[model samples]
Structures are given as C-alpha cells and as structure tokens.
Target: MSAAAPYAALSPDVVLAAVDAAGSWSDGRLLALNSYENRVFQVGLEDGGVVVAKFYRPGRWSDAAIAEEHAFAIELAAAELPMVAPLVIDGQTLLRHEGYRYALYPRRGGRAPSLESRDQLEWLGRLLARIHAVGSRERFVARTTLDRATMIQAPMRAALGSDLLPAHLFDAYRHAAGRVDDAVAQRFEAVGPVRQLRLHGDCHPGNVLWTDAGPHFVDLDDARTGPAVQDLWMLAGDEPMMDALLEGYGQFRDFDPGELALIPALRAMRQVHYAGWIAERWHDPAFPAAFPFAAEARWWEQHIADLHEIADDLF
Candidate 1:
C-alpha cells in the first residue's frame, strides 16, 4: 500500500482471510458498511449469522489505544446498558492480520431514534447519565480529549498545509480561524475547568440506534474524554430537547446548568472542525470523492463567513 492509498492492499480477499484467521468461518458474502475513517463490513457466517467487522485506520490509533477503547465499551455493556461491545474471541477483541487491526461485533439492527419524542429523549437522558456515572469512574490514558487545541488549532494547521485551501483565502482563513479559536479560548477560560469524563464523544442522534427496547450504540470509534455536555449538546439540539434530556439526566446525576454556557462555543468549534477535518483528510480517496465541496473556493469563502459569524456570536 502506498502513502496515497493506504488501503490499496487491503482487498476483499484479504478481508475474508482476516475473518477466517480469527476463527470465524465466512460464507464469502461481504457487504461493506457506511464508514469513511475505517473500513467496516458485514460478513456472512457459515452458521447463517452475520458479524460486523471493523478494520482500523492504519497509523490513526495505537494498538494500546484501540484496546483501551474496546475495554471502555465492554465496561459500558457490562453495566447492562444497551451498548454493543466488541465480541471477544479467544480472549481477544482486537485482532491483527496482514498489518491491519480489526475487531468483530454481533450484527445489530436498529433504526435512528426520534429526537423529537420527549419520551425517547428522556429515556436517552437517563441512560446517558448512567453512562456518565460509569465514565467518571476512571479516565482514558490513551484516548483523545475534546479541547480547542486538538479540535481547532491542530486542524487549522492541517488545513493550512493542504493546497486545496485557496491561495486567496489563505490569509482570510487564518484570520477567521484565529478569531474563532480566540473566542473559543476566552469562553473556555470563562467557563473555567469543566469536569471531563469519558464520553461517547460523537453522541449525535444519527449514532443512536433505536429498537423496541430502547437506545443502543454500535460504534465507540469516536469515544474520547470530554465534558459531559459534549455528549449532550449534539443530541439535545434545542432547549426543549435539552430540558427533556436533563430532566431524565438529573434523575441519576446532577446537571450543571453552568455548562449550558459552553454550547455556542462548542457548536462553533465543531463547525471549524468539519472544514478542517476535510482539509486534513483530502488526501484520502474517500474524502475527495465524498466531500467535493472543499475543492471550491466559494465553499471556503462561505466557511470563513460562517466562522466570522460564529466568532461574533461568541463575543
């Protein structure tokens, strides 16, 4: 595999062989799942059951870090929450084959839960509070932390390096991004140090899968250390949703109303993060093919405008 196409050597034949190497016999039917950072697939088993196989992005995470993530999920599942942890085989959840790291999970099917439903929101809040209760028990020694530096500064550096960023917008982008970061920094300073815990870092509604039982999570690929609010803000897009979630969340753990102040800052950070992440990963074939907007200077101009708007709102 070349640096440009890291997964060029990871062909379908190798995927099937990886499964077999891990002691699971496949029926030779491999259906790719919707994932960009990592290659995930649904492989049919000899027993007619299917398992989800996730191949980690090379060089993105260390083996120890991945193992730590796996352990966190397994811990959450053990709490009887609706979290889907990796299936352990021969005392190993992380497996290696042909220089690629992978893991297996029981195939779970569920639809996206309705964030509009108060009842569903309340249920999710209760469970999320419980998740926080567990997450606060320990800390991640190897995972990422949600902060302006990693979320904003590092990404800005990556974007600066990408040639896709229009030369005309170079200074504009820098000025706009620096303003946003400064605003975010001031807000963080005002908020002081928040009590951060292990979080389902990307707890947006789409990541939530709902069944007749309730909410269950399948991917912890984005799990990291962050303020509890980071997990809540995405799922609770508005005040009413926040109320319903906090209503249930307060049932198990106390809600810090002060954390509410950080919402706008977080929103702006995420906006910058999306643009910067695209710029950083544009070299990946999937990114260029999937996000064609970044190639346009007009898009960058609009992004800078949005950043300016966000900065104005923050101050």
Candidate 2:
C-alpha cells in the first residue's frame, strides 16, 4: 500500500515503529482508515488499547500550519465541544519518525450521520454554533483562510499545470473556471465584509461521526478561517434541512442570512478546487485509483461545460 515518494517510505513496519516510538506499543494490528490527503491508521496497542495515527502528507502542510491545527482542535475539545483532539505524546502532538511527521488520536468510532433526520440536523447545528463561538475567540496565524485566492485561484493554477487537462480543452477549462472565479468574486463583493472565524473547513457529512451518545467531529486537517456558512451549508442537503439546522443553530448564535448568498459561490469554488486537487495530486496512486475519471478527456469536457453552466446559473 505504498504510494509515491514520501508516502512510499511509510510502510507497515514504519507505521508500527512510529507508534512504538510514540510510547504506544503496537500489537502489530493496524487498520487503514478512510483518508486521502494523508495516511491514517487504527493501530492496536499492547495495553489492549487502540488509537488512530495520521501521517501528514509530506510538503502539504508546514509545521507551523499543522501546529495551529492541533492547537485549534485542543482548544475546541477543551471548550467541551465534541471534538477529536490529537493526543499529546511526550509533550508533543506532532512527532517525527523516519523523516515523516505524524500524530496520534484516541480512536473514536461512529456511523455516518443521517442528514435526513431532523433531530440529527438540529443536533449538528447546535454543536456547530458552539464550535463557531469558540472559533471566533481567536484566529489561526498559520492555517489557511477560505478565500478566493486559496480555494479558487491556487487550484486553478495547479490544475492547469497538470498534464491531465486536454490541450484542446485547456482554454475551455480555463475560461469556464475563470467565469466561476469572477462570479464568486462578485458574490463576495455583494455580501460585503464577513466575520471570518475558525471553522471545520470541510464539514460535509463524511467528516462527522455519529453515535447514540451524540456526534463528534473528526479530521480537523482541513480546518481554516472562513464564513460560518462554509461549515453550515455542507451539512444541509436542502432548504428544509437548512431550516431545521438554523432552528437549532439559533439556540446558540445568530445566523447571518446574507452569508446564504455565498453558498452557490462556495459550491462553484469547491467544484473547481476538487478537480484542481486531484490534478495536483494525481501523482499519488491512491488519487488516480479513487478518481479514475479525472484522467478521461470526456470528464474534463463535461467538467468544463458544468463550470460554464454553473457560471450561467450564477448570473
């Protein structure tokens, strides 16, 4: 299960060795967790305990940025929010082994949240408002901010630089994405200044783990500073669901109706960002295997058309 270069060096032996180094003696049992941007594993320990280890993707995040992420998680958990904060091993959350940086988190299990459940939606919303409340208390000095430049412009450059984009479709792709960028810019302009707060930048259902006790959030790796809507919109499937969420959200904090306008723009930016991410990381075998269609010219063609259609809809 070795990937290219840096990740390729992260073998099972290396994983166990790293865990042992973290003072958690591995019992030689490991299960791969659902992760892409980084390598995550559930390793059993001699004490009959189990923990999840996340190996940071080389060069993806700087040490300072990652430290900020860990600090934020610790802050949220300390606030009594249902957050999975990394365990501090040897007085350090970030550890190095075999030239790779990684972290250990207490293994917490749960099933995917039923987004259709009104109770669940309300519950999620309440917790989210609290998370935002804590988030507003401070900001990340090194982590990313969900703005057009980072989410849209940077991804565009990454995708364009990749060889996967068909030469014939290059202009079409660029033009369509450009339109999305432009529309999103205008949308932000109309919305005026927004209160940027620390957010679980990628708060879709997949990132949420649910159990009878309640819901706890995982994977703060994508955490960033952004409008509160960036965290809310992804959790709601439609208008009714959003209403239900806001119903609970109102219990804790005010929800800005104006940020609602940024939803469409965020959608477009995510669409562009997703493709760009795959393009940039195509060198990783897991990405190509997971997103085979990215290699197909027809997909790019359709992606270009979809981008244009999204732009048209924006107007």
Candidate 3:
C-alpha cells in the first residue's frame, strides 16, 4: 500500500505487493483486526498459515524502537521464553511502507481470559518471572522501571499546571497525598525490602493470550528491566487475586516491602496518565470504550483520602 493509502485498505494485492517488495511475503489474504494507536491486520496465506501485520504510529517512537522490539523478541526467543518471534524483512527489522512501520508474527491460536480470573492472574505472575529472567545487556532500549517522582509527580504537576485537570482538585488533595509521597520515598530508601527484576512494562490483560500450551505474552513494546512487581502493580486489590498471583509465580526471594508499597501510588499514577491521554485524544473517532478512565480518576481522588490505609500493606 502506498503511504497515502488509508492503512485499513490492506487487500491481498496490497499485502503481497508490500511483502514482495522485500521479496518475502506471498499468497496472503490480509484481514482487518486491529484498531488502536497502531494499525494491525491478520494475513492468512494460501499455505494455511497466518500472521499478524502491524503498522506503528510515529511519535515518541522512532523506527529504531520498532527494530529494537524485533531484536528483543529474538533475544527472548533465544532464551526459550514463550513469546511470538518477529520476522525481519528486507534490511529492516520491521517493514516500512507508506511512512509507517510494519511487521508480521505467526498467529497463535488462543482464547482471551478474563482479567479477574485467579488462575490466569497467578499464571501471569509466573510468566512475568520467566520473561524477566531473559538476560540482556544489549542496551537495545531504555529500561522500564519505577521512578515514582518522574513517572508520577513531575508529569502530574505539569498536567495540573496546564489547566487541563482541575487545579482545585489537586490542591485539595495535595497535602493528604503528601503522605503517599513520603511513604513511597521511605520504601525506596529502604530498597532492601523489594523484589527487583525485569518486567513486561505493560502486562495488562490484553497483552496476555490463553493457549493450550499456556499463556503466551504478546506485544513487547514496553518490555524492560525493572521490578517483577511492576507486572502486577496494576492488578492490585482483593486478597484472593493477590494470593493467586504470588502463588502461581512458584518461587520467592527477598522482596522489598518498599517496592510493593508503591502499588497504590502506581495505580493512581497510571489512571492519571491514561485518563489524561484519553482526554487529549477525545476527538479521535477510534478511541475504545474499554477504559472507563473517568471513573478511575474519581477512584484516585477517593483513594487519596485514605492513602495512608495502604501504608503497611505490601500485597
């Protein structure tokens, strides 16, 4: 497809033409399946095989980020971790056509599991443990980790200062919320208490697929070295859920209580970031209804009222 063509119009001919440009793709029927920040299509070839074609949006990410993801996938596969191995066509790790980055992965057959499933949640914890163990020092990409002040306060202050969010709300909550900040800092200072490891930076429900073999992780876009708990921080609340996650991981080492204590803080930060992004893109016609982020914003406000409640709980 030409760079000018709407990414949705990836016909068999278009798919072949683009693939053939690299002298790699053939006889594939491209199907529409993805609708998010990136363009994705599923290609079913005449040979009875299928692959996912992705077209990335350009912004904070450069073409090199796409290539790094390809390299990381290879490294992860080499470590025998369960994941989708990416194909590199032409001299590019990802196909660049029409000014967008693209790549294909063999389709894995699986069902989407409910995010609330204890079994799946536990399995997810273990899966993250295994992925983090995949050693890397290639400096392929910037690592993902918990940097509370930068990831939370600085951007939040900017957002509030921009007059995009209600300044009064921040002012009303700031003093009470200061306790969360102090707690977070204290935990970080006593770093001996948290379990640190590599992480799948964005291991939400969608990134995980349930297959007969087990759970296969997809989309290593945010993969990075950081605390293993980063994978589960967003999945907090509820005792059974927390227990299941830790139990499924099947092993324990010294965990920093400080790192785990940051869960509530991280939760609030994620909701703020997500809601702000969605509000910024509210004019886009394709935004999904899956995230009720406005509700989350309200929840954070309420949680801030009792931030001290989480001061001692690490689970």
Worst 10 residues of 3 by lDDT: 1-10
C-alpha RMSD values across all candidates = 0.9, 1.4, 5.3
Model 1 misplaced stretches (Cα beyond 4 Å): none
Off by over 4 Å in 3: 1-17, 20-28, 114-122, 135-145, 153-197, 235-237, 250-258, 280-284, 288-315
Estimate TM-scores for all models: 0.98, 0.98, 0.71
Model 2 alpha-carbon miss at residue 149, Å: 0.7
From the highest lDDT down, the ranking of the candidates is: 2, 1, 3
* Deviation (Å) of 274 in candidate 2: 0.3
Per-residue lDDT of 1-315 in model 1, one digit per residue for the tens? 566777878898999999999889998999999988899999998999898999998888888889888999999999998888999989999999998889999988999999999999999999999999999999999988888887899889988889989998999999999999999999989988889999998898778899997889778888889889988999987899999999999999987888999999989989888888888778889999999989999999999999999999998
* Candidate scoring better on lDDT of 1 and 3: 1
Question: Judged by lDDT against the true structure, how good is candidate 2?
Answer: 0.92
Please, what are the lDDT tens digits per residue for candidate 3 over residues 157-220? 5444543344556664455445555656665565554544445677776777788777777887
Candidate achieving higher lDDT, 2 or 3: 2
